[model samples]
Target chain A: MAVDDAVRTALEREVGVEHEELLGEISATLTRRYAAAVGDSDPLYHDAAYAKSLGYANVVAPANFLPGVICWSEGAPYDRLREDGTEADTHLPGVPAKGVRVMGGGEEMHFTRPVVAGTVVSRRTVLLDVTPRDSKQGLMLVARYQDEYVDERGQELLRSVRTVLLR
Target chain B: MTTPSDLRVGSALAAQTNDTSITQVFRYSAATWNTHRIHYDKEYALKEGYPDVLVQSHLHGAFLTKYCTDWAGRAARLTDLSLRVRRFAVAGETLSIAGTVRAVRAGEERRALVDLDLVETRGSDGETCVEASATVEVPRSWIGEGVLP
Candidate 1:
């Protein structure tokens, strides 16, 4: 069998495992930068006074802000990085850290509560399933991961089922 | 505020456009801690057959989210957002988004759920790069008579 197929088999074996991570706090500066980067001038992400007027304790992260954060850790050394410039340990639960290329397919998200600055968040991610397919890029696997985000108090902020394409 | 009177099934929302720049794409990747070189390395993007560094899929989703949130404002909350990237949009491409109301139903308490169908099109070729849907929860008072229970 090809190495890619073998990798798929290994990935398939890890289906149903749960991975959790404490993503630290959502900083106001981070949220502001994200909103600015996206060219979103929404005052809720920038002005605390405006957010307060809206009944929030402080500025709030925009919709999709939680899932948009790709890496939570400080990251590995440069030498440990893949040719694609991504760190293995930071993502892709089952697949080997090297060789495989990963791409974001899409996302289905539900916002249960607003995420405000200074809120420490945690995520429980489960590999819901993985299916192999043949694409224009040749053999690939589509994996769906359901990520549940909660506040320090365990209140659900949001949940998203993210689709990742591995080649 | 996207009041109930503003959300009618089949009614079209105003269109908004964003002229994407390479700087914007790189900044988004950096802010997200996404080290993917395809979003910053022009050479790598060319080797991958793209005209230039491509926009991240999540960026496409963000545009859709902005579209909904900008329209809804503070009076409404975006409860749900789902999107699929249908094509790759290179840097410097203009992304235009517009939505139409799909349905309205009673939500929790005095809130009403407004569903919208959104499409993000690339201005360079008029091709749709992403298709999305959103559910915004708004005050039921904004709904017109007989629109919802």
Candidate 2:
């Protein structure tokens, strides 16, 4: 599918508009599961006692833990999911649910603080920009989204700029 | 094991290797709630011009994350990580991650920062799959003044 006028216009409208969500607290189980899934044997991520000994309140999350998770909540119902199995309501707000393909191009993350297991976190996401380009497959729209994650006291934990390719 | 005190600008960290398997890939997809067909549907991936179901880009990031955290151990904290996916790796390929200390800088009180250049390369053809850089915060006592930036 080509990046038509409607797609460009829809994406342009979302630039700089912030969408906020309370992603909830970081859990030891989820953090451990993510680390295990990646085959990390580091005791700091698996053992709370070890992490506490190193000055952490609980098991510490990996560097990419927050941005690595695709969905933070229970996720949408099957009917609400896009064709590619992504939630239609979050992330790509202005892009249509169907006929457009979306993929993660890359990310730049600044981990300001370690995420402990019990710290409640919230995210503020804003569409940074969208650029149109021609590719062998067709017209591709490279959209950049900036996300900032903070704890309950408003302390920043992480900030990231992610690039998504939509075609 | 490489400790923060022993790290130098040209010091090399230990390499970790992961043998990518279909089961591992599926579990990664399930863990992340990623329903991308290119990561699991072999037939759909074939249509997309890949040899097999390709590993998710985030999964590649996970491997790199593991490598950094494992190297830093408990005494250090990873402060920044930035990476770009240069190529794709299939389910059965082996991916190896390695890092080199690039620089050392003064950080917040009692902490020193170490900069690392990281790479994840496909074992088969030695092609770079992901290129990354990271900043880790370690205790100032762990670093030697000779390596300070």
Candidate 3:
């Protein structure tokens, strides 16, 4: 898609729509797998007793494991993949910004509390905002998505603001 | 509840480097469901004001985590993590993330809280592309645990 067309489509589209993502319960296996992938051997993330001593009833999730918490609800995989064969959402299926490459500019994470094992989480997402930057190359688009994580009782566990830079 | 105090300020920690490749960035984008084109499409990235497919912000943060943990060693838990992307990270750029101890505290129990000034620099330019700060929990006996010994 042309860069201008893509930009217009994103701007005209509804932004800031609230989405309730049922992330289901925390899984020890997933945590262990992530820890292993990251080459982490922290006992608090693997041993229940160690975690309990730290005031956690079960294993704690890794700081970057937020992607595993939600099943991003959106379109098919193939359609969302960019021309270079990379998916759009990074973790879940979502709208395709074919011409644009989204760079995870970084995130501001507020861990209100620890996510213990077996507690189901609900991630609420809001599109937040989209700003366009006209650079020397052409046009740059900044997309920000805000994800709020809550428990069964509606207590905020974590809030993440993810910003991505696209063309 | 342990606050942000109790950590030694002005101390130093070891720095770490990661030889990041386009393939790794592609896989990260795939696994994370990130579909931003600047990450893998060099043509697109160039057209959008970058030299190549830029690294994701979270990936940069991940590099910071590696730098801290490499120095803190095992038995460390990131009690709090906060990062702001100051610039872009392009592909084929080898980034070395390093940190200096900012503060330390007596965290929840047997945990020493630490804060650091995190930085990511490109080998080619020798300039820090991203600057961040994070709070992590390390065991009080971390140095004696053969991690820093």
- Per-prediction tally of clashes: 2, 1, 23
The CA lDDT at B77 in model 2 is: 80
DockQ, 0 to 1 scale, candidate 3: 0.29
Kindly give the stretch of ten consecutive residues in candidate 1 chain A with the minimal lDDT sum.
Answer: A1-10
lDDT of 2 by residue, B124-147 (tens): 999999999998888888776676
Error of 1 at B10 (Å): 0.8
lDDT of all predictions, in order shown? 0.88, 0.85, 0.66
Q: Score the docking of each candidate (DockQ).
A: 0.85, 0.71, 0.29
Candidate 2 global CA lDDT score: 0.85
Sorted on DockQ, best first, the list reads 1, 2, 3
Model 2 clash pairs are B5-B142
Candidate 2 regions off by >4 Å? B4-6, B141-145
By lDDT rank, best first, the candidates go 1, 2, 3
Best by DockQ: 1
Q: Roughly what TM-score does model 3 have, to 2 decimal places?
A: 0.69
lDDT of 2 at B134: 90
DockQ of 1: 0.85
Q: Candidate 3 chain A: minimum summed lDDT over ten consecutive residues — where? A: A67-76
Write the residue-wise lDDT of candidate 2 on A3-70 in tens digits: 67789889999999999899998889988888887777678789999988888899988778889887
Q: Model 1: per-residue lDDT, tens digit, A1-167?
A: 22287887888887889998999999999999999999999898999999999899899998899999898888788876767777887757886777877778899999999999999999998888989888877888888989999999999999999898887
